[model samples]
Target: MNTEKTSSQPAYEPGGCLTAVARGIALVVVVPVRLVWDALGYCLKHLWRWVLAPLARALGWLIEHLLLIPLRWLWEWLVVPVARALWWLVEHLLLIPLRWLWEWVLRPVARALWWVADLLVVTPIGWLWRHVFAPVGRVVGAALAWAWGIAGRISRAVGRALALVLWHAVGRPLAWAYRVVLTPVGHWLRTYVGRPVAEAARAVRAATREVWRALFGGPR
Candidate 1:
């Protein structure tokens, strides 16, 4: 039997073993380092937003405070007074013709209103008060006096009788009741009658004054 030469596979190289081990170790360290570096980059990318947020806010505040604030301050402290003075000068100087025109335009209406007011409020008030209230007041006084006189006479008669019969204690109360009861009623009647009488007197006085002013003269 011819036996073929059998060759054992070459022994594994030691350097190859070392190189593989080194490559494994390098892979192990490199993977973790790369992972850590990627995580750091992600964290920094996100952290950039948080860092710039406060700086942006601060810059906006600086623009407002440094620029807008001074401008508004100057406007308030200087511009308002200057504007008002210029406006007043223009209104009083340039607007005179307009004022004259406005007044002339309104003059006839104003005169009509003044005449009506004089006739309604002033002339009537003065004339009616001068003539009417006096006479009406006298009439009311006379009526009050009449009622009071009658009441006094009645009370005196009753008092005399009651005193003679030793009932004088009741006389005082009766007299008081007579006065209290009749005074308000009589006054109320006087007020009711006096108001219309006074108004009528005012109308008459006003008419008379007008007629007299027309016929004779306004005043003596």
Candidate 2:
């Protein structure tokens, strides 16, 4: 038999009540925070966009037009002219007499002293160097050259002897040892040890690839 069912209200949930209370509390808490945040944001935006920005622009304009412009003008008009005048006075008034004195008096005296020195000291020294020292220097230089040539010949002979001795004693033995011992050893190692290692490495790589493929179902 079919029973007639009455409509029943859903059961009240504590979670929904708690969620609504939490939402209300959150709204109460967040409203003031959002309001304060918005107020501060508005204040900062306006402060920067209107007040501080304009103030900064005005300060920049004032500095450029008032301070820097005036300083530049003063420098160009007053300081530059004064500096030019000072330079002109120093060049013409102060330096001209000194230059004239130096040209007329000091320069002439210096020239006369130079001529005397040439006549007395330099000319004699030059003559001695040309006539006396040059011949002695030539002799010494020739002797040195002869000695150097002899030394070079002796050195060449000694070097040749050393090279011959080394060839017989050291170089030939080293070459023979390398050819007989080291080359054979290196060849044996490359053939026996290196080949086996390479083969083993290849086998290991193939095995690893097979295992990886088995596990991952692909090469990657």
TM-score of each: 0.30, 0.39
Clashing pairs in 1: none
Candidate 1 least-lDDT 10 residues: 1-10
Q: Candidate 2, residues 19-89: lDDT per residue as tens digits?
A: 99999999999999999999999999999999999999999999999999999999999999999999999
Clashing residue pairs in candidate 2, if any? none
Q: Candidate 1: misplaced stretches above 4 Å?
A: 1-89, 92-94, 106-108, 166-220
Query: Model 1: how large is the Cα RMSD against the reference?
Result: 36.0
Model 2 stretches astray by more than 4 angstroms = 1-31, 57-66, 95-105, 122-220
